[model samples]
Target: MTGNGRRGRRILAAAVVAAALAGVLSGCGGPDDVSTATGSTQPAATQPSATAPVAANPEGTNAPLPEGAAVAPSPTGEPAPEQCSNPTASLRPFPDGAPESPALDRIRARGRLVVGLDTGSNLFSFRDPITGSIEGFDADIAREVARDLLGDPNLAEFRILSSADRIPALQDRLVDVVVNTVTVNCERREQVDFSTVYFEAQQRILVAQGSGIHGVADLAGRRVCTVAGSTSLTHLQRAEPDAIVLTVPSWSDCLVVLQQGQVDAVSSDDSLLAGLASQDPYLQIVGDSLSPEPYGIGINKYDPDLVRLVNASLERMRQDGTWSRIYDRWLGILGPSPGPPVPHYQD
Candidate 1:
């Protein structure tokens, strides 16, 4: 059985035992003597029952929330659709699949593909406790890209990045590629290049179970937490203007705030929110996605060759069933596989 399942069963059994003890305590008459009758007739107020998640901030806070935590940019009208204009947009991988290029040359000389990704994102690209190695859907995909480039899957370095750092990492040449769960949009494309969409997910709400909240519409005047620099924040601001949006540096922070009752709900792509929920069974995702998020690898705007190579890697993964295997490993618990997203190239 999975660790989560075992933990859940333990919590369930503890709850049953607690309830039984409470019942037994209630049945016992406290000192059925005249002295007790004169003291008080009403039973003492029962302390609030404890549950699986008894602490508000189990993960703890890193730093105080940023200033203007509730403030967000006003909607700039509906987002414009993205367009691709690079020379390699319409190009295909080399005849051999692994093409020779300066991009490939730099990576081979360096001996490792520096990949920017999130270590805190649970199922996407997190470090496993047992192996102490970062492995997840995105991490696995990045490794495949590295193996194709350098001929060794482990010849890759994972650089942790926050939501805001993805484009900057590529623009500054700090990393050759970013496999973080970055969404593709026209504005972002202007800053960094992107491979074809590898995974498509939709925005949704995550809340502690039994919160009585259903979806985005129910967030009016409620405290909602989302990572700063994420599109989910913008959608939340526009969809529920009255809601108090709390911005944090990472999604893990949002989870901390939500657990502490500092936020009524957390919002993000379902793929990401699923990771959060899996960590704590008390939490659950609610409502439909606020918008579609097409995840793409962030490549340097100047490195179209690398972009093409990464796309080639993705194409092979899809055709060879590697993509589905990764999905089953990390994301199958969410639901049955939906298959890989079709690649779209615009010249």
Candidate 2:
């Protein structure tokens, strides 16, 4: 065939092939199918209708828990005090020079403080989406410890930990210190030492606004959520034996379940619940405190000197108004600074 004739035939063949391909694509979905940018077609019904009212529970049932979320086993009995008289008291601050210890020496040699915390914790320690940097009350406290130890706050390395992992991380020496919102108790003192109480929180309940679940009294027969391995769980079980308790990996998970209608309420520290409630205007914290929750920095039990050093830094922060500044910056939603908790020292 002549060159022009061959080119014409080739164009005709290409047109036929394109038409066949189009026919096959159109056959794959119904008329209601929507074309996606990736060349895939999805049922238009999957797309939410503009006029369809959103259901609180879309599946007509409780939403599935997030991965790793679990229902806590029923409490066997009230937990014993383990002979702890004053869990809030901690080692005295180091006098003046802040003498060095093996733990401090190791951290100095490493040149940075390895601090463990939960980035999922909203007001305490969470990541900033825009900045991609961790910013919260606990993060700042960890930085202060780094500043006192390494002479630079930026030298601190943050390690994200789960609620159940905080104690193990410290016990295993995985992190130099844990600035997570850990309650100091005699049971915990057995495994790790703690800095003096940095923040005093009170346990409370968070529920949907006007849920008629005013307090712990209303929690009976209702599903409540809290983080696993938390003091909140213990207190909750004791406060209301009839309530169904669901435990998740983080407080954020509790927020998720609450929003999905999987649970009626979330029980935790008022400080933590404030963070959750702030994220969703439909939620509110209700009722008086269930119990006092004294937060302390977790240090390995073997590191008494490091504990003293951390306590010293906390003392300086309290006196210099750094604590108040941090509180006002992150927790102003909870109200005015209660002024940093009075430090109790065991001389």
Candidate 3:
């Protein structure tokens, strides 16, 4: 071969090699590029991804707020029931063993206790992905009630309810009772009867690690998220009037927005915030509790007899160590069992 031909061939081969290297570098993105492309550095095994397929909320977008959730709070519109010195004080339970009542008769006839609760409430009552069954602290509590009434812990039928639907479900007799984390107070007492306080929760803040938010005081002018129709929202609004409060339909939705950077932080009961934190190690619960929330089982107002029966069942759970067992199974993350809340009788 001629010298000129060899020199031209060498230059062309060198140019080709340089072009291929450029393409390879572009295909293998840098660390910043990977972070921006994925929108987060959180481990996929630990946290949900926006593009990942979720069994619930298939679209992967934040769940929509329930109807009327964005509107201003409305009055209950009926004559408020007489105020009680202790709203958590409930009817005295009947003696355990063969407890009978008219409401119990109706429920026994139905054969399955219809319990209302939100499945998206992690640690409280959420769908277990592996078993495809709803299981949590609150779910176990409902099962206990079913065991007492129907003699089989698995005989209860769970009805999914939004936070706002809790009172209406009881009033309309759609469910035998609500085992969701409902706060017992005077306003709800007028609408539905309550069992003794089951779990005591405290409102607090959840934020990404290194977030400037240390407490409610740091929330002013910052975007905060919580479930609509929740006492958490009311307390947050009262605590920081200037905060840009974002209300969603579920606590999971609050976690989604916070992860997506649509909100600065999430505020809710520490029990709930802990659940969110468990799903994402990047998140943390901060600050002292804002308020004490006494959770109770909600029943229809006319079913005073049923209330007595439920209170009786709760007492049995407390004495027999079932409450402690269930709490440890689901809520040991919150530290040692505090034991069950002491029952108070108005009678």
How large an RMSD does model 3 have? Answer: 18.0
Off by over 4 Å in 3: 1-84, 96-100
- In TM-score terms, candidate 3 sits at 0.77
Residue-level lDDT of model 3, residues 1-347, one tens digit each, is 56456445444543433232222112211111111001122311222222222121212354433222222222223443576688899998887554567788889998988898876689998877666677899999999999988899888788777686688878988888999999998888888999999999999999999999999988765667787678887778667654656556678878886887656899999999999999999999999898899999999999988998889889999999999999999999999999999988889
Candidate 3: residue pairs that collide: none
What lDDT is reached at residue 311 by model 1? 85
Please rank every candidate by lDDT, starting with the best.
Answer: 2, 3, 1
Per-model C-alpha lDDT, please?
Answer: 0.72, 0.78, 0.75
Q: Quote the lDDT for 162 in model 2.
A: 73
**How close is each model in CA RMSD to the real structure?**
17.8, 19.7, 18.0
User: Model 2, stretches more than 4 Å misplaced?
Assistant: 1-63
| Residues 189-273, model 2: lDDT tens digits | 8889999999999999999988999999887656788987799998897887556676666799899989887678999999999
lDDT string, candidate 1, 73-135, tens digits:
333446545555532242354457666678888888889898887666889977666666787
Q: Cα deviation of 193 in candidate 3 (Å)? A: 0.6
How do all models score by TM-score?
0.77, 0.82, 0.77
Per-candidate clash tally: 1, 0, 0
Question: Between candidates 1 and 2, which one is better according to lDDT?
Answer: 2
Give the distance in Å from residue 34's predicted Cα in candidate 2 to where it truly belongs: 42
TM accuracy, model 2: 0.82
Candidate with best TM-score:
2
